[model samples]
Target: MANMQWTLLLLIWMGQCCVIDCQLYEFHYINKEKTWTEAQQYCREKHTDLVTVTNMKDIKRLINISPGNWRGAWIGLYGQTDGTRKWHWSLPGVEFNESEKNWNTGEPNDKTGWQNCGIIWKNLKWGDLSCHDHQYFLCYDDKYILINKNKTWEDALIYCRDHHHDLVTITNMDQQRAVQQEAQFASTDYVWMGLSYACTLDLWFWVSDEVVRYKNWALDGPMDDCDMSGAMETKGNHQWCKKDDTEKFNFICST
Candidate 1:
């Protein structure tokens, strides 16, 4: 590694002994210094990988983990070496969007030399820099939490965003069981989840961008409508229920 500078960036592995589904992605800040490539390898071996910036919300989280003012770190995005200058997220399955550019004014410029790697700037914007330039970088981890107070789906979402992360997403039985343990203490019959129905698309989706691979719907099946959102029973099988978005209930948040 060359020109490595110090900043906190590292991924601490999660609880393996627990029965709960703690697959919620988390950003870790390690103080260790390394080159961009070294940082990427370290993250992949220690946790998931370098951070992926999906939206402004992710940017805000990245900024929160930042060590100090004017300091920056490597993100998952990088430029093509073929001179196409095409940008791509390092995490597979995440597609780069033309509309998602948060480049600071007149950036990705070659004036700084053959800039190829993407680093998040202190201004909360992305810019191109040398991959060989060592710096502290962010790696991601995962976890979840339960909020016992009752509130509407929208309100619950706001609370989770304000206090923790977004609403929890359960894509498998491991996660379902883990979250269900928290649900048992809910004040309401059902707990607000991140699931929602898109009427135009006519499908249920997780608000956290997780694909609905696994399901635990009630016997009657999911109710699909614009006003419908997902919840989990606090009792019985803890199957998912389709409820109106206006309904109030306890909720889960990822940490």
Candidate 2:
């Protein structure tokens, strides 16, 4: 295993629960215009981070809130410093899929060579513009917050309860992907999740009081034992594994 950073301060990416029937984050339309950076600051201060739209449903919701000749609105998507023209969601752990793009015809031309920021056009497709340009933006309250600080599973639980809601609960695949995005940034090989074993009951259950119906166990079955909780790997496939509760690692929280 990689070495751990026990005392490092970590950033919490306010994430949204992207369940098909439920969402942990709520979106808001800022009618007032601001530069991309300014808008980002506003959102971080008042709400969660800027919105991280993972699928078509998010776009539809954005459109529903910002109707009428929408003009253009800033989104969380941005160009990386590498100039790969690689677009990344503002929230860490959220993914940007090339296949699911909603770009306008002949869009992202970057014709000016410096149109690095992203915006949603009136037609609901995406376009590129200068980051300095002023425009309205969208923000989500809270979803899946990744806490980078390393802590034991028990300590992590207390921290989450004091700061946000509870540790994350992955009851479905969508929630799995949602939490997996944040897991990718963990300083440790794996990040603590909310599931734990109950030796008396002889079963694993989510701390959020949900059943372990949506299983993503790394092995055929998780080890049923005492002093074990669940953690998700940071790399490939991001499957869940039973981890010792006394072990320290970063964690994700559901809000």
Clashing pairs for model 1 are 7-31, 8-29, 8-30, 8-31, 9-29, 9-30, 9-31, 10-30, 24-142, 26-141
- State model 1's lDDT: 0.76
lDDT of 2 by residue, 1-255 (tens): 122111111122224432422564567767777899998998889876777756776567556655454566788988876735588888765668888788889988887877878888777788888888888887767578889999999999999999988889887776787788778878999999989999999989988887777789986569888999999999999999998899999999887
For each candidate, the alpha-carbon lDDT, in order, equals: 0.76, 0.78
- lDDT of candidate 1 over 93-200, digit per residue (tens): 567898988988888885667688888878778888888887768777536667878799999999999988789987666578658867877889999999999899
- What are the per-model C-alpha RMSD values against the true structure? 14.3, 9.0
How many residue pairs clash in all the candidates, one count each? 10, 4
Best by TM-score: 2
